[model samples]
Target: MARFFGWLFLIFLLGATYFWQPDFFQHSYSILKHGDIVSLAEYLRSFGAWSIVVTIILFIVMTFTIVFPFMILSGAAGIIYGLFWGVVISWTGEVIGAVVMFIFARYFFRQIIAGWITKSKYLKQVDDYSAANGFKALLIARLLPLAPSGIITAVAAISRISFKDFMLATIFGKLPPVIIKVLIGHDIVFAGENMTRLIVLVIVVIGVYVGLWWYKRHKDQNKVKY
Candidate 1:
C-alpha cells in the first residue's frame, strides 16, 4: 500500500539523517543543555544555507517524533538569526512541522494515534472537547504556551476538526508564544552583561513554567470531570 511506503520512506529518512550526522542527537541535546546557542548557531551557519536547511529538517523530524521542545529551538533560532529573521525562520519551520505531522496523523496514523491517546484520561477529555469545539478547543490548547504541541497535532488529526480550521488556529495560537521565546533568547544573550535583560529572562522562564503547571492542573481537573 502507499501508506506502507510512506512509513518506510520516513523511517529511511530518519535513519539516513542519523547515520549521516552521527552526533546529531547528542549535539541537539548539547544545544538544549548548554543553551550556548551562539556557538551552535555559529557552527550551523558556517555551512551557509545548508545550515537553515538542516535546522528545518531537524525541526520537522523533531516535531513528528517529539524529540525536542519547540521553545528550546525557538530560542536557538533567535540566537542564530536575530529577532526578525528568527521569528520568520522559526515560525516557518513550526508551521511546516505542524502541518506535516497533521497530514501524516490524519491520513496514515489516525487509528494508531487515536488508539494510543484513548489510553489517557486527559486525552479522552481532549477528544471529547475537540469533537464538540474542534477549532476552539485546539486553538486554546495551542495557546497554552507550553502544552505539548505534538499531542495536539495528533489529536487534531484524529478529531473531526477540519484541516483548514486546525492550521488557522495553529497560525494564531503558535505565533505569539514563539515570538516571546525568541525574545527570551535575545534577553538571555544580553543577560550576561545587562542586569535588566537577565531579570527579564528570569521572569519569562518562570512564567512559561508557571503557565505549563497551571495548564496541567486544569487538564487534570477536566480529566476528572470528563
Candidate 2:
C-alpha cells in the first residue's frame, strides 16, 4: 500500500507541476532563453525574506524536471548572493535534489532495472563497473559539463554502490562544477571583467578531461598486459 501510494504521489507531483504551472515555467524559460541573470535575481529577490528558500526549491524542482538548465539558476544565485553564498545555495539544493532522486529511483525502480541489466551483458558490465568504482566514476561524471546528472544518479542508484559512497561522491564531486558555474555566471553578468579567470577555468576543465583520458588509457593498457 505504501509503495503504491509512493509511486502514485510521484506521478501526481510531476503531472500536476507540469500541467498546472505553465505560467511559472514559461517565465523561467523566458529568463533562461534571454540569459537574463539580473532579471532572474530580481525575480527571486521579489520574494523578500523567502528568496533563498525559493531559490533552493527551484533547484530541487529543476533537478528532475529540467524545465530549464541548472546552469542558469546557479548563475542567478551568483548574481543574487555573490560567490560564497551562491555556491552554498546551489550546492545544497543540487545535492539534496540528487539524493532525493537517488532514493526514489533505488526504491521504485532498482528491481526492474536489475532484471533488465541481467538480460544485457553490456548493461551488466556497466553496472559492475559502477559498483566497483562508484565514487570515482560518479565524481568524474559530475565534473564533466556534458554528463547528465539525472542519468548518473539513476545509474548509481540501481548499481551495487553503497549509499555512503554515493553520498560522499556526490557531495564532493558536485562542488567544483557548482562553484565554477556560479563564478562563470557572475562573470557573464558583470561585463566580462573576469575574462582571465574564465580562461583559466576553461584550461582547468580541459586539464581534467586530459587527465581522465590518460588514466583510462593507462588502466586499459595494464588490463591488456594482465
The lDDT of each candidate is: 0.76, 0.84
What would the per-residue lDDT of candidate 1 be over residues 76-182, giving only the tens digit for each residue? Answer: 67777777988888878888899999998888867766887779998777667776788887787777656677888887888868888898999888887678767
lDDT of 2 by residue, 115-161 (tens): 99999999999888888888897887887754567778887899988
Which parts of model 1 are misplaced by more than 4 Å? 20-26, 112-129, 193-226
Query: Model 2 compared with the native: what TM-score?
Result: 0.85
lDDT for residue 5 in candidate 2, whole number 0-100: 99
Write down the TM-score of every candidate: 0.76, 0.85
- Pairs of colliding residues, candidate 1: none
lDDT (Cα) of model 1: 0.76
**C-alpha RMSD of each candidate structure in angstroms:** 4.4, 2.7
Model 2 residue 7 CA deviation in Å: 2.3
Model 2 steric clash pairs:
none
